[model samples]
Target: MSTLTRARRKLRAHPVAADAALAAGVLACMVAGSFAEPHGPEGIDWGVRTPDVLSLVLMTLAAAALAFRRRAPRTVLAVASGASVVESVTGDPRAPVAMCAVIALYTVAATTDRPTTWRIGLLTTTVLTGASMAAGPLPWYAQENLAIFAWTGIGATAGDAVRSRRAFVQAIRERAERAERTREEEARRRVAEERLRIARDLHDVVAHHIALVNVQAGVAAHVMDKRPDQAKEALAHVREASRSALGELRATVGLLRQSGDPEAPTEPAPGLDRLDELAGTFRSAGLPVEVARGDEGAGLPAAVDLAAYRIVQEALTNVRKHAGADARAEVSVVRVGPRIEITVLDDGAGQDQDHAPGGGHGLLGMRERVTALGGTLTTGPRYGGGFRVHAILPVTTRTSGARDGRP
Candidate 1:
């Protein structure tokens, strides 16, 4: 990396001592320059003054502070401003003594804000210039006083320009950082939304089909001792339900796996063609299930067919579970205009209905599934004393299109 980066990372590699030695050498030169001449004004003391040694010591201290000025600007400025005031009031030539003050002013302007620099710079210049003219052995309009004014102003102005540039760069960095954060947040939100959509699909498909399987298994075990033909039919229903569940589950899960990793297993989803076999499953379980079709042999979108089959299957299962043992259920599949309406009705008081149509997540899953296909679902107690579940699923499944909802 760069030298500054290496030095910042490793504290021991700093050049503080080397810089201090260099500043000391420069200070020595300035001290020597002050003693060489005193051309402060035309008629002022042109040679060395009486208090030259003390003035040299003060100027030397101010110049020494320059070594640490970059590290601690405020401290360096304080020392340099003090030194300038002393020299303007005591030294023959304000001379090289004001050099340290100029460096410190520049450091302050570059590091601090304009308002703070203005306040401190004006104060330093005012104190030093006024002190040199009012207390020094020179006239008020001496060249030394004019030189003090010019040098101090240069230090403050140059430092302020450097400060402005640094502030501008920092602002640009902050704006880029903010935009990056917003992009990351948007990406995270999209990921979460996709995951939820996948999960809802899994829950609806698995819960509906698996419940049918469980109900079929129970029926086979219960009637196996008495009715051989009915028990065999119940077992057949169990096989159909399990096989259907496994197929849908595999296809739904495959959509999520990475394409390059490995091939995803899939099985075709059941549609309206399976409706007769599904209705037979409930009839074989000792519950009377009657189906009447009014679709006129029309084919629906695969998603609509699947949603309609599940809605009817779940409703019939609830009838067998909650309705009285004597209850008879009706299943109707009808095409009404642009929608396919499939409804299940049981003539048993649902209060005794251990498996009402809207219990648990079955009905909720049905509603979500139908709605996703751009349809409507309504389930509740029938007006008199039964339960009814009606779902209107669209022939053209809207969710199948990418434009249905964009991530």
Candidate 2:
């Protein structure tokens, strides 16, 4: 920083030192003004007469009181005002001691409220002006008496204005800071929602396609020599599933791409309308999947549709991966009075069927999607020999998105 700026900061940091310097300046001005005679024979003349000992003593006391103006403004004002009143009554020329009182009044006004400023300011002006008019060597209507009134009023007015400006700037700074905090919170919320949506998309895509690829690759390996044609068909299914997995992964990850990068696929998100195709993929992979729909002609919101599709896909993927070689899966969708209910069950007696699948994200992803849509899910071991997954989704979501209210 520059020299002047550094000096101002130091002065503000040590206000009493700054006030002492101000007191010294006021003392110099008072001593100098006491020597001047405005009504001299040749206009205003300097060094016409020196102040009396009593005037000098009062001037010194008034200036010294100003050194503590900021520490105790009202007390300093009272001291300075008393000294100026004594000088106005006792000194012949009234050595400009009221200047210190004016400075003290300004300090009082700046540090206090408007009502206090007005009360203290008016009282100081009246006492000093009345003392000079009624008891001084000068006449009651002299300009010196009126000047005390004008100067004190100016000090009070200027100090109040400065206080008002300081308050205004502080208020604006607080408002901007509050707005900045709100923007940061909103941005973080949006980021969290987007992350959840991407996670759900990735889980659904990988769980469904990887399960199919794993099944097909195992079949191709088991029958490679005995049934070459069947093995080749299984390899072809593996290729298709792999390709589908890549496409879905690209679409989900593309959400994080920068603006200048290649655009992601514009294919609409899967919904219950694609239930037959979803089931066919599992059926071809050696699992029997039966899908029944009771909401054939019902229209569903986009978020609800996507969430429903993901729930079914995850549930079936779990069944295929954990529900042994002879597993049979069934899915049902029904619309009932402002809600869409989905149920997926499997008659698989696989050992892993009783436990969580894929580190538990499958079930958790399904639950997150359902909860985001103001829905409920129930998943547990079946009564006899299988596992059951059921979810109820709102036809119209409370929020605006499928995964946590982000479009």
Candidate 3:
């Protein structure tokens, strides 16, 4: 960097040393000004008369006090003003000790509030100007007395302006930083939500088709030698289930492809219209699912349709996996006013239906889907025998404004 820039950075880093250097500079100026005579035959004359020993001593004390201006501004101003007053009363031509007081006043104003700056600035101006006017050998109306008042006023005003500019810049910096943090937080939240949506889709597809494949494979193994024809049919069913699983998995994973990748599947998501086909797959897997529709062909929102379809799919998968072989599940979809209701009931009487083979996230996933679309789900064991899954969804999805329109 440039030499001037490096010096400024060092001054800011070591303020005590910078203050001592400033005091030396101010002392030099004061000693030089002491011998100058403004009223000489020439416009002004330097080294016309030397200052007394007492005036030199007072000027030294005032400059020394200024070295501590930043640490104790009020105390420095008091000391500098007192020295200036002593020089004003006794010296024939007063030394410029009051220059130190002006610098001290500026420091105080820049570090303090406006009210405190005004009070201290006015007090320093009155004391120094009044001392020069009332007791100096020069007349009360001399220009030197008035000059002290004008310089002190300028110093205070300039300092207050600097403080205001610094504060404004600081406020703008803080606001920009807060905005950046908020944007990062929002992006993270969207990533988390998208991950959850993809997880649910994968689980529903894998669970439904894999369960069928497992059942058909077992049947094929059991009948391999005794019943060759039945075994062949079972193997065929396994191939069909695996094929379906692959198609669904491909479609689900396609969603993660970037814009530059090959185009993804555009097929509409499954809904109530696919109920018959869904039942046929389960029937072939040895679970009898009976579907009933009571709503006279009314349209449903895309989110609601997908949620309804998944809920039925998950509930039936659970029945086939946990319920006894003979268990029969009944699924019903009915539209009532502004809402559509779906119910799945199974009379399974199987082992503890509360827990599935590998820990059950099926119920939890279903609940999250329903809740996202502002719907409600109730699932538990029926009183007499099996399990029941009931869900009520608004025909027109009423998602919270915060949702990212995942469906």
Candidate 4:
């Protein structure tokens, strides 16, 4: 960067040293000005005109006070103004002691509010000008008295402008920081929602297939020696169930892969169209599941279709695990007015499994899926025995079209 830019940055880094240097520079200028004649030959100024010892002492004191202007601005202004008044009243030819007061007034104006700057700046200007005009050898109309008024006013005006610019810059910086924080919070919220969605998908896939595999594996172990053919068939079902589970798992986890990875499987997500296939898998595992539908050929929104399929899959999986072996499940899909309804009823000898150990998250996941699609789900014990799950999903093209619009 430029040399001037580097020097300013260094000064800002060491405020005390910077202020000390300012005080020294002001002292040098005032000391040099003290000797210059205010008026010379032909009504102009020249040569050196030395001030009395008291004026010199006051000038020195005023410049020194400027070193701490930033630390105590009001106190420094008071000291500097007092020194200028003393020089104005007592000196034969007034020294440029008021230069130091002007600097102090600028510091006060820059640090304090506008009202205080006005009060202090006016008081200093009045006192110094009045003193020089009334008590000095020069008359009230002397150019020196007028110069004092002008310089002090310039100091206050310049200082106030600098303060306003600093405030404006600070406000802009705070607004930018607040916008950055809001963006970060929005990103985090989206990430959390995506994680929950993936988690629910994984749960549904694993729970359904694993339960079937467990059942088929148990059958193979029980009949391995007594019925070789039946054991082979059971083992084949286990292998098929496991392969399907892996395929679904790979598809689900593929969503989390980086862009550089191999392409994911193009197989379409399962829906009600696969309901019979899903039921067949349960039948092979010894849970008799029957599906009935009155919706006919009506197309569903992609989200509603997926939700309905998963609800059925999860409900049947629960029935196979918790319902008695003799229990049978009936799943029905019906178009009722403006909504599609799905009901799964099981005659299994199982109690309310919602509060049972290891059964909590299934119902909650179902509820979340239904709610996310702006649908409603109810699950509880049936009138006589077993469990029931009923869900009502909107069938409007508008709802489905909205879901289609999302990534």
lDDT of 2 by residue, 42-91 (tens): 98899888888998998899999989998899999999999988888876
TM-score of 2: 0.85
| Model 2 misplacement above 4 A | 1-17, 38-45, 115-119, 122-143, 350-358, 398-407
Residue 265: error of model 1 in Å? 5.9
Q: What are the Cα lDDT values of the candidates?
A: 0.77, 0.89, 0.89, 0.89
**lDDT by residue (tens digit), candidate 1, 219-263:** 788889999788888788778877867877888888888969577
Evaluate residue 297 in candidate 3 and report its C-alpha lDDT on the 0 to 100 scale: 80
Q: lDDT tens string, model 4, 355-381?
A: 667787888889998998788999999
Query: TM-score of predicted model 3?
Result: 0.89
Best by TM-score: 3
Per-residue C-alpha lDDT of model 3 across residues 1-407, encoded as one tens digit per residue: 99999999999999999999999999999899888888899877998888889988988999999899989998999999898888888877558888988999899899998999999889888888888999888888989889988998988898888888888898999999999999999999999999999999999999999999999999999999999999999999999999988988888898999999999988778988898899999999999989999975898777888899999999999999888899999999999998899999999987544576664688888999999888899988899999999999887664522254646
TM-score of candidate 1 to 2 decimals? 0.64
Q: Which candidate would rank higher by TM-score, 1 or 2?
A: 2
Worst 10 residues of 4 by lDDT: 39-48
RMSD of each predicted structure: 6.6, 3.9, 3.1, 3.2
TM-score (all chains, Cα) for each model: 0.64, 0.85, 0.89, 0.87
Q: Which ten residues in a row have the lowest lDDT in candidate 2?
A: 350-359
